[model samples]
Target chain A: MKELSLNILDIAMNSVGAGAKNIAIALDEDDDSLRIVIEDDGCGMTKEQVEKLSDPFYTTRTTRKVGLGVPLFKLAAEQTGGSLDIRSVPVSESEKEHGTKVTAVFNKKHIDHTPLGDLVSTMVTLIQGNPDIDFLFLHTVNGKSVRLSTAEMRKELGDVPLSNGEVLNWIKEYLTEQYKEIERL
Target chain B: MKDKVALREEGSAATRIVVGMATCGIAAGARPVLNTFVEEVSKAGLLDKVMVTQTGCIGICQYEPVVEVYTPSGKVTYVKVTPEKAKRIVEEHIKGGKVITEYTIGNK
Candidate 1:
């Protein structure tokens, strides 16, 4: 993907497809590298699934489209002399806690490093489609941070859906303002 | 734009336009299609009547940037949708209630 945000969006969709009720996207950035950790409380994948994720062909051959998102992310990271790590626990009825966690570390100073695009739009699109799901986004640049949690919003909103045009607009503004605020830091 | 109170009372929008937003679709430019639908639908004052949303790819890699329109009757799947086509869809199929067969998946 041209933009890191697009890669994040694509990967997040996998979490959503996995029936995740709660998804957390965290970006920890500094002068050296940008680390993205996307954790999901979904019906996790098996060991085989996790192992096969890096191979582009294995994913595309399967019907579910595991190939496109992960491979692109791995390529993007590897191009910058960084790496992608994936850990998953297969869904087990006996175990209540099971999900997937993906981490991609990118060398910020590398010439091939893909820049983070409009992440605010990515967040809006995710919330706009899946209002029922809880999405928590946190970005920490140096020491300053910007965060949003739909779970917190639901407490204040009562019956108001996140998909509401008004609410989505507010989220867009909130994130955009936070991004601008981060730039001043 | 409807407030929280009015949006809750009326329930969700009656019609839905679902854009495929997976890697395949996004790579093929689904984002513009989605934004265009949302913009044109709102521009036509049809937000109350129609809602533009997104979903993961539905396994159609070749015919990506797919959009599906759902109404009272059924769904009409449009393939390889662009920003311009999204606007026409809102004006003709959505607001005008005339389906554009040429852009549909079955056009082949």
Candidate 2:
């Protein structure tokens, strides 16, 4: 993934493929930590399924699914001296509303680099296009928050798909600008 | 300081092509597209005119192979791109300044 956001998108896509209707992402950046949480209401996995998810060869899907997304996320977290936690519930119990939550916490001081810009852009792209799905994103820097609602971008773009060239370019520029602002620090 | 500032300015002025070359993209045949762009730019001796870069994922896995071109003035994204289409992009868009509407995300 170009950034964490891309990784998030990949995982979120898996959730959707698993029949999720809602996905929530929250990012918190502070002097000491950088935290990311992605939650989805989809068909949750069984204990056996969750246990094998980290294996590169395990995938329940039919499409060339050599499951690497979760492993990669775990590696990314570990690289930053961070941790990853994942939990899932089956759809049968929740009536197709399976919930999965993944949290990663990084040591900001140790991991001096993270692709926050790409993360935000990816989130924006996925959230804007999937109107049937709702995504809530909250970004915090030292306790100050900057929020982006996919609902807001959808209204602003007026029927344009988030994947459209114009909208993608706009998101890219927006992300680039946000990174520039962060670089000043 | 002088050299750094000049380099930064030059970097921003160059045309860039970012190919989505991750697994999803590669499975959809982005490698050949990237190779073709590299070859065409080199053969045309327009190395300075364009720079080819690879990116992980564009988030639209369904679109599989994606290519984005960022000129000095505008950015264009082409989705579900193939090698033949990549050649057309190099010949038409990169060299001739015309967008291939059929392959562009805009057409979709």
Candidate 3:
């Protein structure tokens, strides 16, 4: 993907496909690196699935012969002398607390690293596509942070759906303003 | 939440354009297709007149970069949409209010 945000969006879709009701995306940027952690309370993979996740040829999609999201992300991280980590515990009726976690660390000043694209749009798309899910996004750039929680938004919204255009506009403006603030700092 | 009520009061616009941007769509180049729609719609000053949003997984990955248009008339789905096609969609279907049948899902 040309943008890191695209990669995030792609990976996040996997969580949705796994039936995650709650997804958390955290981006932390320090002097040396930009780290992303995306965790989901979704049906997770087995040990074998987790092990083969990075292989381009391995995918659960029957329509296509290959899945490049993970492998491409792995390459993006590794090219910058960074790393990608994936952990999952398969879900079972007996155990409800099973899900998947993915973390990618990228060198801050790496020349090859793509800029994180419109993340607010990414978040909004996720919410709009899966309105019932709870999305919590935390972005900390040099310790200046902006946190957004849809669960809290829902509490405030009462019976109003998140799909409302007005609410979507507000969310966009709020995130854009926060992003500008971080850029200024 | 009150804001949502306010939006509902605003009611549905006469037309809405939805772009599929799921992983399948994006991998097939829906990002540019979406960007084109947003840009064209805004440039045409139809931001308030029309609603442009995104969706996930139309369940037809092979036919992606799919875009769907919803008007009072009905719904039309376009497949394998590129930026150029998106421009035409805004100009012909959206502006002219004529469904582009040749590019529609039913045609394929």
Model 3 chain B is weakest, by summed lDDT over 10 consecutive residues, at B3-12
lDDT minimum window of 10 residues, candidate 1 chain A: A59-68
Of the true interface contacts, what fraction does each candidate have?
A: 0.31, 0.00, 0.21
The digit string of per-residue lDDT tens for model 1 on A16-69 reads: 988899999999999999999999988888887888888777755443757668
TM-score of chain B for predicted candidate 1: 0.90
Best-performing candidate as measured by TM-score: 1
Q: Is candidate 1 or candidate 3 better by DockQ?
A: 1
Better of 2 and 3 by DockQ: 3
The most accurate candidate by lDDT is: 1
Residue-level lDDT of model 2, residues B1-108, one tens digit each, is 112111122244267888875557744665557656665675675655576666666578789789999987689999988878888898899889898888988788
* Total clashing pairs in model 3: 0
Q: What are the Cα lDDT values of the candidates?
A: 0.85, 0.67, 0.81
Better of 1 and 3 by lDDT: 1
Interface RMSD of each: 2.9, 12.9, 4.4
What does candidate 3's lDDT look like per residue over A57-163, in tens digits? 76555523226778888888998999999988778632688888999999969888778887887776677556688999999988899889999999988877676
**What tens digits encode model 1's per-residue C-alpha lDDT throughout B1-108?**
224344533446778899999889977878668767866775676778887878776888799889999988789999999999998898899988899999999995
lDDT of 3 by residue, B38-101 (tens): 6678678675678777777768989999999999888999999999999999999999998888
